[model samples]
Target: MKKRVGLILLLFSVFLVPANPNPVVAQDGKDREYYETRGDIVWEVPTDKKVIALTFDDGPDPTYTPQIAELLKQYHARATFFVVGSRVNSFPEVARLLANEQHELANHTYTHPDMRRISPGKLAQEVAKTQETIYEVTGAKPQLFRPPGGYYSESIVNIAKRAGALVIMWSWHQDTRDWSDPGVKKIVNKVLKNARNGDIVLFHDYGGNRKQTVQALKEILPELQSRGYQFVTVSELMNHYGTKKVGQGN
Candidate 1:
């Protein structure tokens, strides 16, 4: 009789346990591992088509931002700008202009902290503020987040994922390193020499004298176009490569 009563209690506890058991939270671990094993983050889309994404960081600069927009328009290319929150507040019109021109305006966090060193709460604030600012200014919610300096942690990735963003890093080979004010020829060569299908080339529209970046684009855009390559926003590149599952924006 005592054994029968204990078995009943055990069955009762099992029935009381919640089914589904927070599936989203349960999957977060798997998702986090998926991102980490892919070279710190989604550096490049996996594809064989002659397509690539040109991403700019640290801006919406009053001067260079507009100049970069014009250059993109001229070349009939589309790129993504990972913008800082404070700068977005300072230059909503620039953000709007990029959105208006069909260029993607994504989050680069507020104040641009090295995300690996910050707490998850601080990281969330950085990303949330940027997302709020961008949405307020452009009426488009950003689906992509690029941590400042390309530094990330598992916590960073989970925070971004929970906030509805996919962390975007860039191909090591395709990085222009334009923030160093590299000369136009060097910047141009870095991209043209190592260019490939599904490559995400990093450039900067702000954070210093970006005259070289502007000039490099003038050469890079046309040369890539001539080579039968098409420039795309990060989202479009992901779409072509099927990096994210359908209906799964992350």
Candidate 2:
């Protein structure tokens, strides 16, 4: 009876635990070689020039996007907006405004699912649909793609590569964490303290009470400008760094 009870408990435990607890599916081993030869995820550019890329995610928010755009315009700075497909559809004019103002409109997926667990076909659709939406609205296909929530697997990178987008990740040092709405002072301190050349600072124009972000930028932008930093889009940062691939170093 004791052995039988122990065996039953073992069986029950097996059922409780998942085969892959982490949702991100692992790609085939051989595919790594193939993807390695292709593009890589860019964090920051590799240059000595005082240039940085400012990227905003989850927008084209009708209210905050215009304010952010106006701020960028006021600072004479450029930024990259990784927009969601559904938002672009909802606000086509705002999407057009992003492109028209010389800000880049990159893909952030259609529904913004965590790409790690999604099947390749579903992932392809997510990326392709956003690509199509952005192209239709902006007349330009984005060369950059940022995985939702910055969760990436080999499979996710493969899908973005197949769709002709280089995956973009931000430097660990520069993440503003504005999504948490940590107040304007914390957000300002985060970027201004770590400001450096080839840094890609992340911000959000949408996704919630971005008035704090707008306010933080008002302080961060001019301070950085006074310190001689030039704000450029992500692609331009990659070009400046001569980064040809995404996961090259990893």
Candidate 3:
């Protein structure tokens, strides 16, 4: 009787677990070892060095990209811009200016679609087209790619890797959300309060009126500089200081 009861309990436990294999059900990197190759997915690198990576997305905007680039210059800061392929084609001069200013140009897909919802072939095309576009305008091939909205899967990462770019995700605590047109003060406070060593802060250049971002940068740059934090591109942060094995921002 005891043996039969133990067998029945084991069978019941097996039935209780869900059979769906997608890691989206549990994103905690437990079964993610296979996908986390060579620090391909990065949220923020871990280091004691006072270096931070500021990443801007969805750009090549005629108005805002130039303005942001100027502010970065004023601060003697370097950042990575994840330029959309379509935007690069539309504003090739703006794209060139970013590369010229010593900023790193990373890929952010051609149309910024939800990678999880698209077929694997379409996702591959998005990454390939952006690489070609960035190289065409800047004469530099990007080594990093940020998926639209930070959404990813094994397939997306694999495709990006095949394109020879690691996936770059920003620090969760440092998201400024300036694309939503949040008040300039709010944007400034979010970045200032949460800025940390080896953090990758997210900002946007194209989704909307980016004046708040410009205004906040006006505040953020001077203050972070005062704190003795050096701004470096994403690649520099990873290659120079080394990356944390498991990254957040899925």
In the range 216-238, model 2's lDDT, one tens digit per residue, is 99999999999998999987777
lDDT of 1 by residue, 1-250 (tens): 9999999999999998844311222323454346646533577877888898999999989999899899899978899999999999999899999999999988899898854367789989989989899999999999898888766566777788877888888887887889988799999999999999989999999988999999898898899999999888998888666456311644
User: How do all models score by TM-score?
Assistant: 0.83, 0.83, 0.84
- Model 3 off-target regions past 4 Å? 1-38, 243-250
The regions of model 1 sitting more than 4 angstroms off are: 1-40, 245-249
Q: Write the per-residue lDDT of candidate 3 for residues 1-250, one digit (tens) a residue.
A: 9999999999999999853322341343433344445455777888999999999999989999999999999999999999999999999999999999999999999998865577889989999999999999999989888888777666777788788888888887888878778799999999999988999999999997899999999999999999999999998898788644212222
* Superior candidate under TM-score, 2 versus 3: 3
Angstrom error of the Cα, residue 148, model 2: value is 0.7
Off by over 4 Å in 2: 1-39, 243-250
Top candidate, metric TM-score? 3
Model 1 error, position 93 (Å) = 0.6
Ranking by lDDT: 3, 1, 2
